[model samples]
Target: MSERRPTLRERQRSETRRVIQAHAVRLFTDRGYDAVTVADVAKAADVSAMTVFRHFPTKEDLVLIDQPARLIAERVAASPATHPLVRRVGGALVDAATALTGRDGDEPAANERFLLDCLRLMVSTPALRARHLDSQYALQQAIVDALGDDTADPDTAFRAQAATGACLAAMHTALTRWAEDNGQTELPELIARALAASFGDDVVATGRRD
Candidate 1:
């Protein structure tokens, strides 16, 4: 089957979202996250405040905009059915890191300062930090849905949660470490290394005892 392309409205919506995000980032960088309001972002982006809210449901979402839930879900949905759940999630995260870093392979994006700044803001702001935790739980639930019907079984659900937690915990560790390092290191590398360190030789193995 041929893949579906986005409609014109969808394209326009995406472009508008990008414009709003760019403006919001600049505003946040200049005046700090708490100081800038959604109205300020709307004015800078040359759109109405309602439009800004339509694009980003919350003020903190302007900076925490990357859709980790959707990204991981799509990759998990695309994986081969026979693949182990843990490996599928691990591979999904590697793919997500690559996409986030804007590289097909191991290379990183040229300009990650903006992302680092956004992460820093998320760290320092209580609202954004809380939203970050919410996002993580949402991502885990998305992963559970993508991992198929087996999650309905109690044992399978436990394994699913373990696998999801391990992968996401690795990702969070990598993000914090990268921000602390001032982004001197490539984010994709840090993410990959963190995943490897967490899973070691058995990315497919769930930590459940028999």
Candidate 2:
């Protein structure tokens, strides 16, 4: 089935968000996250402070707002049910990250720069680093919701949630390394390597592990 195009309102909201984020990041970069206020971002975006708040609730959110929880959940839900939970969630997470970044090592330079800046902001700033945990929790909840009927089963829920947590941790490590290396290396490869090292083939690969 063909994907539905975004409606006019959706497009407008996205543009508004883009403008707000661009202004926010530039200001944050130029003056530092601590120094720049939401009012500053709002003014820079040529919008009201309320408009900026509507798009980004907390100051930390402007930097940490790109979590692809819905995308990850959708991918996991659409995957074959027969697959192992870890593989399904891990593959979905990887695919979602790849989708945001385009080809393995070749995301558009601007997009890559944006991600690098966000990653650096999250890593270097103490408050953003603390808020990062909440984003991870939100991602975990998304995976659990994607499990659907499986979430009702205690053992299945436990396993699914565990896998989600582990996968998110692996992803965090990969992202941090990507920032550390200045995005020179491919992110998908880093993420894949992290998952493999953390989970081993038995859990990460498909089919029975006999």
Candidate 3:
């Protein structure tokens, strides 16, 4: 069965976000992220600052909007938690990394360029780097919820949170290194290696533990 197409409203919203982000990136790259204001981005995109804020709550969000929190949560929710928590969390994050990097290995070349620019900005900007840590907490909570761990059980909660944290930390290391390398290495491979190192040989290229 074919997947349902997005509604007209959803399509328009997505297009608006795309246009705003494009203009924002251009301005930031041309005139340093610190020098460019949200008002500057709005003027370049020909939209109001209100519109920009509605789409991206903060200036840092314009560079860091595309996180994998929802994707990871959904993937974790789809699987049964019969396996070890570390394996479940590790597998989910590794799978999200593969999807973002390119499942078919044919994601547009333009997207690769865009990601590299965004990653570079995040690495160099102090405000964006700080905001990035906040996003990490949100993503960890999402995974914890998806796993449906018993919040009242101290041991179970710690295990769930620890597993998610370790996986996220591994992915974060891989991503930062990728930015430093200027995207020279394949992202999925870096993520796979990082997870394998953290998990001690359980993670595979396919992101399957079994």
Candidate 4:
């Protein structure tokens, strides 16, 4: 089936959200995340406070709004079922990381600095850390759902959550290292190394066990 295009209203809302995000990044970077209010972001974006809230419900969201986890979940859900489950899920996260690093144009070179700043802010903020944990839980559930298994059983749910946690850990380690390097290394390269460190050289390999 052909893909349905976004409506004009949808496009407008997306653009507005982007504008608000950009403005929020600038303000947060200049004044610090804790100091910047939602109203401040709205003022910078030339939008109402209500509009800012509509796009990003909380102050922390201005930095944490990117949906890499959700995108990874979608990729896992859409992966070929013939592959081994580990390979499919890990490959989906790798794909999502690549897309997030701008392989698919979701990120741009200009935004890398902004992203780094936001990452630093999240690292230092307690509330943002809690929100991040909440996001991670949602992402974990998403991965379990994508696996197409009956995860109602405690053991089944635990395994699914464990695998998802590992994937997220790899991505987090890579991102933290990349930020520490001040954008000198390509994000995808670091991501690959981190995943390999966790799962060995054939991180996403679907080969039979020896």
Give candidate 1's whole-model lDDT. Answer: 0.80
Runs with alpha carbons beyond 4 Å of true place in candidate 2: 1-4, 103-108, 201-210
lDDT of 1 at 150: 65
- Per-model root-mean-square deviation over C-alphas: 4.3, 3.1, 2.7, 3.7
lDDT of 3: 0.80
lDDT by residue for model 1 (1-210), tens: 999999999999999998899889888888988899999999999999999999899898898765656877988888776767767887787777657666435444543666787788888788889998988888898898898886889899999999889888998999999899887677767767787787774662322111
TM-score of each model, paired residue for residue: 0.86, 0.89, 0.87, 0.86
lDDT of 3 by residue, 1-210 (tens): 999999999999999998999888878878899999999999988999999999998888898755578878888887665777767777777777666665235443566667778878877889988988898999998888887754348788887898789888998999998889877787767877888887777554435634
Q: Report the number of clashing residue pairs per model.
A: 0, 0, 0, 0
List the global CA lDDT of all models. Answer: 0.80, 0.82, 0.80, 0.76
Clashing pairs in 3: none
The total number of steric clashes, by the backbone 3 Å criterion, in model 1 comes to 0
lDDT of 4 by residue, 1-210 (tens): 999999999999999998999899888778877898998999999999999999998787887855776777788877776765566667777777666656324434665666777777677678887887787778878888877764668897787778778877887888788778876777767766777778777755441122
Stretches of candidate 4 off by over 4 Å are 103-108, 150-154, 205-210
Candidate number of the best TM-score: 2
Q: Write down the RMSD of candidate 1 (Cα, Å).
A: 4.3
Clashing pairs in 1: none
Worst lDDT run of 10 residues, candidate 4, spans: 201-210
Model 2, 71-146: lDDT tens digits are 7888888877887777888788777777767653454467777877887888889998888888889879888898
